[model samples]
Target: MSDTHLLICGNSFNDVDRDRLSTAYPAVYVDAPADMAALESGLRASMRAVAFKGHTPFGAEAMDLFPQLGLIANYGVGYDAIDVGAASARGIAVTNTPDVLSDDVADLAVALMITQARTMIRGHAHVASGRWATEGEIPLNRKVSGSTVGIVGLGRIGREIADRLAAFKMDIHYTSRSEKETPGWTYHNDVVSLAGAVDFLVVALVGGPDTKGQVSREAIAALGPRGVVVNISRGSTIDEGALLDALEAGNIAGAALDVFENEPNPDPRFLKLSNVVLQPHQGSGTVETRTAMAELQLANVAAFLEGRDLLTQVN
Candidate 1:
């Protein structure tokens, strides 16, 4: 059998990173979980690590294929797709690329907020369709600056978003597991109260079961008709049904979403809404940030293989 010890799974990994991993280790590449069975025949028993990058579920059933596997280094900060509990039970380790992508994700969140508030998409369409020649101007839109904004989950990315918004002189509010030491920002114990207190709500929470549906129907209602929602975090963080119903009924003014519950192909209902701006989960897709994430992922894998401490261990 070959001495391949690293199995790089998922199609999301760029060619540059794939080549780098191949050069650095005895690696085998497979596109996704469905293709794993076919590749299993050739994989060496020495496989000890997986450089995972896709959204497919990697549970105990999948892990059972490789008896020697010890580490799963994830390319993205969010590892919801991987069952860390199962990894732990098997005496395996898990690592993710965190702080490296925080700035980029936060920048996208702020951009989404501004885009939705100013109706930037519609304005571009109006100009492109030559309506600007016929109509005097696009209808006046909501201003983002000087607005009251609430940030949910003030971790690394959340703090970055809040800091950027502060430059616009907006009032910032946040909810976290514990209160922070920011005297200028308001703190809310719950998401519902945070929603009620702000003109815009930006979600920057982590993904996983703990955060699932944290933004409830009541929180959506609290935002009222004039409020806008911006989410750069995981889609499961919000109640999708409530958000869809609210958008349809104009309960909130609009939403700008980077992630979705069912991504790449989100619910068809979202595509029909004119008040919404949808993105295909590209918050950290910039060339610089993606390269950094890939480097960090590889660094963690190398650390585990070389008997060194992991750069960003989650489990």
Candidate 2:
């Protein structure tokens, strides 16, 4: 039997990094978690680690396939798709690439807020479609600078977003599990209060059941008309249905979303909205950030294989 100790899964990894992984270890590449069953015939029974990279549900059943598996190194910072409890029960360690992608994600969050506020997409379309000459000047858009902004979940990435927005001379309001030492910034005990206090609401919360739909209908309603929402965090962190309803009813002015409930193929409703700006969840898609994430994932896998301390171990 081949000593293929590493199984690389998920379609997010690029060709260069895939080649690097194969060259570094006796690795078998599975395109995605869903294809694991079909490729089971070719998988080495001695596989000890998995380099996971997608948002597929990898549970105890999948873990059972590799009796000797010891680690699941996630490519992204969010590992809610993986069953951490199941991994722990099987004596498997989990690690994710965090902090490295924080700045890039934060940058995108700020970009989305600005893009939505200024109606940049519409302005670009107006110029490209020759509507600028035919229809005269584009309509005035909202200003982002000096506006009051609310940040949901002030963790590592959240803090980065707040710091960048602060440079825009905006008032920062945030709601986290605990108050952070943010001088001059307002901290709300709840999301609704934070939403009501700001012109823009940016979601920076983590994923999982606890935070799923953390931005509820009440929060969206509290934002009210003229308020813009920017989300760069996981799709589940926001109540997509409430957001859609608000957009349709003009309860909220606009939204700039990088993540969605159905990513790469979000709701068709979002397509028709003129006030919304959509992104294909590319917050950390830059080459520099992606390369760092890949390196961190591989480092964790290598540590597990070499019986060294796992870098960024989750459980």
Give the best candidate by lDDT: 1
lDDT of each: 0.91, 0.91
The superposed Cα distance between candidate 2 and the true structure at residue 56, in angstroms, equals: 1.1
Q: Write the per-residue lDDT of candidate 2 for residues 1-315, one digit (tens) a residue.
A: 457889999887889888878899988888877777665644646789999988879998888888788999999999999999999999999999999999999999998988888889989999999999999998888888899999999999999999999999999999999998889999999999999999999999989888999999999999999888899988899999999999999999999999998877898999999989999999999999999999999899888889899889988
Point out the worst 10-residue segment of candidate 2 by lDDT.
36-45
Tell me the spans in candidate 2 whose CA falls farther than 4 Å from its real position.
38-44
Candidate 1: segments with Cα more than 4 A from true spot: 40-44
lDDT for 311 in candidate 1 is 87
- What are the root-mean-square deviations of the candidates from the true structure over C-alphas? 1.3, 1.5
TM-score of each: 0.97, 0.96
